[model samples]
Target: MPDSSAVHFTNAFDIRSVGCSGDPTMFEAFWRETGDAAELVIPGWQTMSYFSDVGNVCWFMEPLFDQQVRRLHRTVGNAAVDGYHVLVGTGSTQLFMAALYALSPADADQPTSVVSTAPYYSSYPAVTDFLRSGLFRWAGDANSFVGDSYIELVCSPNNPDGAIRDAVLSSGAGKAVHDLAYYWPQYTPITRRADHDIMLFTVSKSTGHAGTRIGWALVKDREVARRMTKFVELNTIGVSKDSQLRAAKVLGAVSDGYDVGGGGASRHRLFDFGRRKMVERWRMLREAAAASGAFSLPAETSGQCNFANETAANNPAFAWLRCDREDVEDCAGFLRGHKILTRSGNQFGADPRYVRVSMLDRDDAYDIFISRLASLK
Candidate 1:
């Protein structure tokens, strides 16, 4: 198999690949400007308490990190964190599992079903079912399921396809968890403030710092917050104090870029930089797709962006591409044959005609992808 598992740099950075990696070029410049803002000497004796709070909800979460989270939300105007308890995790994935644990009926004898709409994040089924947890089980698509004792995951500005979504099951017994990972201004318009009982956010998507592994949840109920915290406590004991500290600094820098906007070398803000790159990449992708006549893409949508102070459209993180040629049975496999890599639609519980392509790779890989795609007959 030519060691396809590993990336081999031959003639170019391969565009045939995974779901992530938005260009980090701007983030590099951001750090060069703001890296020193939250310097921590980490005295060997500090954070030895193994706790940031006794309550366990924010146990390993640094207080300053908490403050920065609040400040950043205020600056962005995307989410409302006031009166909401923040639960920190290694990443939103942990918080997601914790939400399932908290929402599932503790008294139920059988596992409570957890679900989302079709074309859900590909990993949800595997992650939810992996444990076969007595507390919860992965039930596909909320639209089909007719049972109670269910927890619905709502990924606004959803994965695989970028459509905004809400709880379809409206059953009195169903509880909804909003995954707002891509609700930030860079990916979508901040049309309104989200005040959900359980909401997840991640630095990986928000600020292009996936390697840091820091994510948080906003909980409206104290009991649910406590339960989610207990799951986190048992899962990792506590999130890394070091990571929390670094994230606080990075988040603070992001807020600064938004708040204190002045022209020149220091003018680059995280969201602005990300939005610009994404907009340009989307334009090019659309152009290539139209030229190819071999592929079809999602319809474009636009709205009034409250944060950007102008009308704008959503720029999805991943491109949901479908092969236009009826001869192609599987879009992902067809792309593979063309030396392009893509995730199959079946992973998201969709048909084989559709595939998912990351629109966030570097220039060379993206250019190669566009050229090859446009050349397709």
Candidate 2:
């Protein structure tokens, strides 16, 4: 038999090519650079160790778990998680799969179509199909002919667009599941009085705590929560206890004003600073794209929406630009050659001329990006 390891199997389906276009955050690379030198976590997480045994029960986590759940709900004004009793998952991504399991019906009508707006989080379609075994389909745009009996996936301040969908104030409407992954006190205004259950968020984006792989789900129904918990129990045996403990510790410390001290500004301050920097970067890119006359962006920023007031008050953090000129074939590859990576619009079911630029980089790097993009013309 041939040596299995020498088959060069990666060429068959280069999974790395997916999500490979964008420039990863320096922080992520830095964290991985540590290479197990010390515990990868906030200072508070250093207090806890991953030594929990399997035989032990989850009784020790009752209080902290309750606190984390309540804090998430109160901050987001989404009572769905409170109603369902969120089960701690390995990460929000795991919760996402659990949600698919909870919502998907093997014998149901149409095999549970998963729909969302354009320029969505790139992983939505892949995760849905991967976890659902080709049962789930990416139905684009809830308003654009999404047949009945479909679950729409919505992301607020959406991954690439940073646009939040208009929320439905009432219950019993099965439009879609909203991913409030980036919704937080710092990024969005908390004017919510009604809780739209079926939302997922992770500490990765919110607290820069990606390594912990900690995430939470909010839903209004006990049945949904219980079902999701069941799925979690089957996958990875109910997450890691030590991860939970460390997350709880870090959350408590941060809420009580203890900084992670990760060589950046405080949580709120860092977010605020990042937000401002993103807005500035957006302007620079918009100017470059416009100056090149080779691209056009979505009108969401200038279009009518609840965030109209907010958009007017503040600049956007994402640049959803599209290349109208026929010369450009792959926006991502074209940008990559310039040493500036961007997400291809095709991945989000958008036009190839379109590219999504994340504005989360530091001001200096962002400036370099603007210069390079401007020179492309």
Q: What's the distance in Å from true for residue 245, model 1?
A: 0.7
lDDT of 2 by residue, 89-148 (tens): 677888888887787766764666677777677888888776446445666555564445
- On TM-score, the leading prediction is 1
Which ranges in model 2 have alpha carbons more than 4 Å from their true place?
Answer: 1-62, 72-84, 106-110, 131-141, 144-146, 167-175, 257-268, 290-293, 298-317, 362-365
Q: Model 2 TM-score?
A: 0.72
* lDDT for 113 (candidate 2): 66
Candidate 2 pairs with clashing backbones? 80-219, 80-220, 81-218, 81-219, 157-162, 323-353
lDDT of each: 0.82, 0.59
Candidate 1, residue 27: the lDDT equals 44
lDDT of 1 by residue, 37-148 (tens): 5455777877677778775466777898888888888888888998999989898889999899999888998899888998999878988999889889898988889887
Q: Name the runs in model 1 displaced over 4 angstroms.
A: 1-7, 15-45, 260-266
TM-score for each model: 0.91, 0.72
